[model samples]
Target: MEPGTHDLRVLIGRQRLCDVLFEGLGAFMLLMSLFILAALFINLAIEGLARLQPDFFLDFPSRRAGQAGILSAWVGSVLVMLVTAAAALPVGVAAGIWLEEYAPKNWLTDVVEINVTNLAGVPSIIYGLLALGLLVHQFRLGESILTAGLTLGMMILPVVIVSTREAIRAVPQTIREAAYGLGASRWRVTRDHVLPYSVAGILTGVIIGLSRAIGETAPIITIGALTFIAFLPPAPVSAVPPFINFEWLSSPFTVLPIQMFNWISRPDPAFQSNAAAAGLVLVILTLFMNAMAIWLRYRARKRIKW
Candidate 1:
């Protein structure tokens, strides 16, 4: 062979080796992820299985520990999760849409972009501190469900915004141009064409953000969420003469992570078991959110015409 051709063959052989090595590394990481997931499921099941009695779901936390169920924590978690989603979704989606579609490429937008990226990396504990300062101290909101929800909403805001932007950006430019060509206004193009196409991605991001918010304990704790609550939260609206009340905003609530933390801190062996059970519940909740997001994405892909 010519000398030039021989050198080229040698370089090509080296490149092929590097590619094979990278592929193997990728496969190894995937297998490791699966193994870790399986191990976690096994460990959680073993710890929580014997404690998964029906009463575990129905009963409230007890001093006896063994008799304690996760009722209050479960309800509180659900309420907080719902409230946080309510507060975060609209704001996050709007901010995302504006940044991705409407915001001019200026220094202000660049600054906003940088701040959002920085916010995503900020610790949950830092958000808790912010909530403490802003909600509890400044606003005098006290330790309440609304305060906790708002704090979590802020904590997850960056995630939701970034996810939403990515989702909107994923929609093909051709569709938007087509809508505009058909005499649609920018708002109409976004609302009728782009938004519908990106709904699944947005929902997936929302669900993932919610999962993170629900599992977080630090911000709520900083905002003075109680470790224990004996009573159910009052309804946000009442059927009585006045009809509406924000009294639910004033009541104490116990989230699952807070309850789990409290349980794990107890010296009793039974509390450890309860903590394990709570952890199992939390894992299940996260998994359910992820599964729903996956299903939504799958359906969205199936519905796409091209």
Candidate 2:
């Protein structure tokens, strides 16, 4: 063999060896992440499995740790999430659509974009403090579910807005042009063609934002949500002619994260087990939200070809 050919072969062999080493390193990193998650879940299951009774879902927290359940905590979480979604979704989607579709390419628009991107990176604790001043103190909403929900909505708004813009931008420009060629109004084109195709991506963002909001402790705590809440919110139905009651929005509330935090802070072993069980429940709830997002994305992909 020629000397040049042998040197080239040697170089090629060295490159292949480096590639294999990098691949092995990547695999090792992934496995390490999975191992950590598995170990955490296993520990939680062992501590909480015995406490997973029907009453665990039905009863409210009590002075006795054994008798305490997550009824009020979970219910509060659901109500607060509903309010957060209501406050965040329409505004985020609208802001995203306008910015992507209508905003002129100007310095003002660039500034708005920069601020929103910056907001997404801001710490959750800062959001909490902001809410403490704006919603709780200035607005006098007090320490209530509504206050907590609105605080969280503000915290997650950037996530939704950025996600919505990305989803809308992902739609091919050809689709919009074709619709315009067909004499469709811009709104009609956006409503019928662009949004339909991008629903999956938008929903994925919303679900991820909601999952984070549901697990948050700082904003809610800063807004003065209690660690222990035993009473349920007022029924949605009322005997009065108005029929629907919304007074519960002003009621005191506690969510699973706050409850778990409370339990985990206790000195007793039983409370530690309670905290583990609550943590497990919160994880299950977050997972369920993500699964629904995945299912929605799958359905959207099947229904829309583009």
Candidate 3:
């Protein structure tokens, strides 16, 4: 072969080698992830399988690991998530809509956008400290369910807003123009044309944000949420005519992660088992939320055409 032909062959060989190297690297990374997850599941199962009794879900925290349960922890988690969704979802989505659809393309808008992105990347512990100083101290919310909700809501707000903006941006400009041409105002266009196409993505983002919030231990801990609680919050339902109670918002709370942390820190092997059980429950809850979000996204994609 000529010199140039030999060089070309060498180049082809190097290209093939690079492709094989990258393929192997990708496979190795994937395998590593799977192996780690498998190890975690196996360890948790070994520790917690026998402890997954019905009473484990019904009872409250106790000194004895066998008597301790996740009742308050899980309930508090649910209540906090409810408050978080109620607080963050509307504001985040509205902010996103304003920024994407209505905000003037000016320096102020650009600065605000930059800040929001920065907030999303801020350390979770920093948010905790901020919540500790601002909400717990300044506002006097105390270490209650409301405080936890507010802290997590603020932490996840940027995630929701960014996701919502991206979803809205994904709705084609032509769609907005067509709506405007049909005599629709900006509000009407967003309400009818933009939102319908983007609700799935918005919900997906919201749920993912909530999942992150659910797993958060730092901020809530920073705000001084109790790690062990033997009692439940006041019931939302009442026998009287005004059948709802909001008093529980002020009650002390312990989230799943906090409770799990408490157990995991104990010297007893039984407490370690209990912690694994709690962790497993939390993982299941997070997975369930994600699955619902995925289903919503799938349905939205199938139903909404360009």
Candidate 4:
């Protein structure tokens, strides 16, 4: 063989060696990370398993650590999350579609997109401050469920928007071209073809953003969410005509993270246990949301033909 051929073979061999070394290093890092996660979870379960009773979900928080429960906290978390989802879903999805599909390719849209992308990485506290000024004071929404929901919704809005744009962008250009060729209106094509193909991705992003929001303590606390609340919001259903109550939107609230924070901040060991239990629950919830996202993506990929 010629010298050039020999040199080429030596370069290929060196590249494979580098690949093997990196592969081993990556595997080691992965295993070490998993080991740390498992250890932390095991410790939490050991500390809190006995305290994680059914009553933990049913009873109101109390002065006595053993008697205290997360009834109001969990309820508020669910309601706030519901409002967050409701507030963010349509607006984020719509903004994403318009930007990606119809926005004029000009300086203004470019600047808007840049700001949105940058907003996604801004600290949660900045959003909290903004919400406190705009939602709490300027708008007089107060420190209520609606305020908290909208605050968290706005915090995650950029994430949803960015994810949605990416998902829509992922739809093959051929699909959009074919639809246009067949005389489908832009709205119709987006509604029928692009949306269906991208729904899974959009949902995964939304859920992941929600999971991040659910654990946030700063924004909620900054917005004046109560750390301890013994009462539930008014029933969302009423016996009166029209049957649905809107008053709950303005009701004061708490959440699992705040409850955990309250418990952990106390000096009592029993309160520590309670905090551990709440932490366990919070972790489980975050994990479940993430798992749902993974499942949605997997199912969508499996169902897609091309």
Candidate 5:
């Protein structure tokens, strides 16, 4: 071979070798991440599995020497999770839709966008402090379930907003154009075409956001979510003669994280075991939400035509 061709062949071989090295490094990193995750799951299971029992889900916390279960905390966590979803979903989705579909390209929108990006990076504890001031002190909501839910709603709003916008943006522009071609108004196109297409994405984002909100303790604690509540929240709503009431809104609630914190802080070995059990429950709840989000996304992908 000519000398020039020989050098070119050598260069190509060196490039291929470099590519192989980089690919191997990437694979190694990916494997490392999986290993870490598996180890964590194993550790959590080892610590918590022994305490898992039906009674753990059926009894309420007791300060009276030996009779304790997490029933009230479980109920409180459910109420808080539901309330957080109720408050965050509509507002976050609306904000996202407006930003992605309607907001003018202006400095004001730019500023709002920047602030939202920053807010997502803000520490959870900062949101907790904000909740303490705004909900507990100013609003006098007094560590109630509503206060905790609202605080978490605010904490996760940026995440929901960002995810919803991405979902909305992913809808094909051709669909919107087709709607308009049919003489549909902008509102009609959004309501009928865009919104339906984006529903799965929106639901997935909402579920993931709620999962994070459900696991959070800082913001709720800041809003004074109780460490223990003896009572289950009143059924979501009531319809007695001449009155409609949401008693859950006014009730004090305890969540798994708060209960775990209380248990883990105690001197008793049994309480430590209880904390591990509560941790296990929290992990299961988060995993269930994640699975649902994955299922929704899979369905959405299956339904997409293009």
Candidate 6:
């Protein structure tokens, strides 16, 4: 064999060995991370699994640990998230669309973009303070469910906006060009081509933003979300008149995180168990939301021809 052929085979063998080593390292790191997460979750489950009964979700918080539940907290969380999604989704998606498609590229737009990117990284506590000053004090929003929803909405607005822009940017420019070449208007092109292709990405961002928002206690607490509430807000659906009531929006509320916080602060071991139980539920709820998003994204992607 030629000396050069021997050297080439040795180089190939060494490169292959390096590739195997790198692959092994990556697999080890991934498994280690998964193991840590699983261990923590398992610990939480062990601490709280006994508390996971029907009454635990249906009853109210009580001084007696055995009688306590998270009914009001979970209800408030659902309502707040509804408002948050309503308040953030349209506004965030619209702003992203306007910025990317309609708005002129200018210094004003540049400033807005830069601020938005920066705001995504801003501490949640700062948003809490801002809401306290602006929504609670200035607007007299009164630290009700509306105020908390708006606060959390604003907190995740940057995430939604950034994710939206990134998603829209991911769409191939060729799609837009083809539509334009077919004489479709800009709006039509965006609606018919860009948005359809980007819906999966947009939805992923929206759900991911919501997942982050669900666990946030600082901003909602700062905005005066109650730590303890025995009563729920007015029913969102009524039998009379318009059939939908908005009174809940103005009603004071508490969420799972604050409920857990309240419990954890108590000296009683039972309360600590309650807190652990609530935390476990919160983690599960978040995971479920993410799983739904992933499923929807998969289905959406599967429908596309490209």
Question: Root-mean-square deviation of each candidate, in angstroms?
Answer: 3.6, 2.3, 2.1, 3.5, 3.1, 3.4
User: Across residues 1-306, which tens digit of lDDT does each residue of candidate 2 receive?
Assistant: 567988999999999999999999999999999999888888888999789899998989987989999999989999999999999999898889989888999998899899888989999988889888988899999888898988889888998998899889989999999999999998999899988778788888899899999999987887777556889999767888799989999988999899999898889899888889999998888889989988987787677666
Overall local distance difference test of candidate 3: 0.91
Backbone clashes in model 5, listed as residue pairs? none
Q: Is candidate 3 or candidate 4 better by TM-score?
A: 3
TM-score of each: 0.88, 0.92, 0.93, 0.91, 0.88, 0.88
TM-score of candidate 4 versus the correct structure, residues matched by position = 0.91
Runs with alpha carbons beyond 4 Å of true place in candidate 2: 1-19
* Local distance difference test, candidate 4: 0.91
Off by over 4 Å in 6: 1-28
For residues 1-306, write the lDDT of model 1, one tens digit per residue.
556988999999999999999999999999999999989988878888788898998888889887998888888888888779999999999999989989998999999899899999999999899989988899998888888888889888898898889888889899998889999998999899888888888999899999888899878777777556767888767878688777776778898999899988988887888898999999999999989988988888788865
- Expressed as tens digits, the lDDT of each residue in 1-306 for candidate 6 is 556988999999999999999999999999999999899799889989999999999999999998999999999999999999999998998889888887797998989888888988899999999999999999999989998988899988987887788778878888999999999999999899888778887888899889988989999878877556999999999899899989999998889999999998899898888998999999998898789888877886677655
Error of 1 at 145 (Å): 0.7
Weakest lDDT window of 10 consecutive positions for candidate 6 = 297-306
For model 3, state the Cα shift of residue 235 in Å. Answer: 1.1
* Candidate 3 lDDT tens digits, 1-306: 567988999999999999999999999999999999888878888888888899999999999889999999999999999999988999999999999998998998999899899999899999999989998999999998898898899999998999899899889999999999999999999999899889889999999999999999989989988556888999888999689989999999899999999998889998999999998888778889989988987887788777
Name the candidate that leads on TM-score. 3
- Candidate 5's displacement at residue 181, Å, is 2.2
lDDT of each: 0.87, 0.89, 0.91, 0.91, 0.85, 0.89
Q: Supply every candidate's count of residue pairs whose N, Cα or C atoms clash at under 3 angstroms.
A: 0, 0, 0, 0, 0, 0
Write down the TM-score for model 6.
0.88
What tens-digit string does per-residue lDDT give for candidate 4 at 122-219? 99988889989999999999999999999989888998898899889889999999999999999999999999899988999899989988998899
Error of 2 at 83 (Å): 0.4
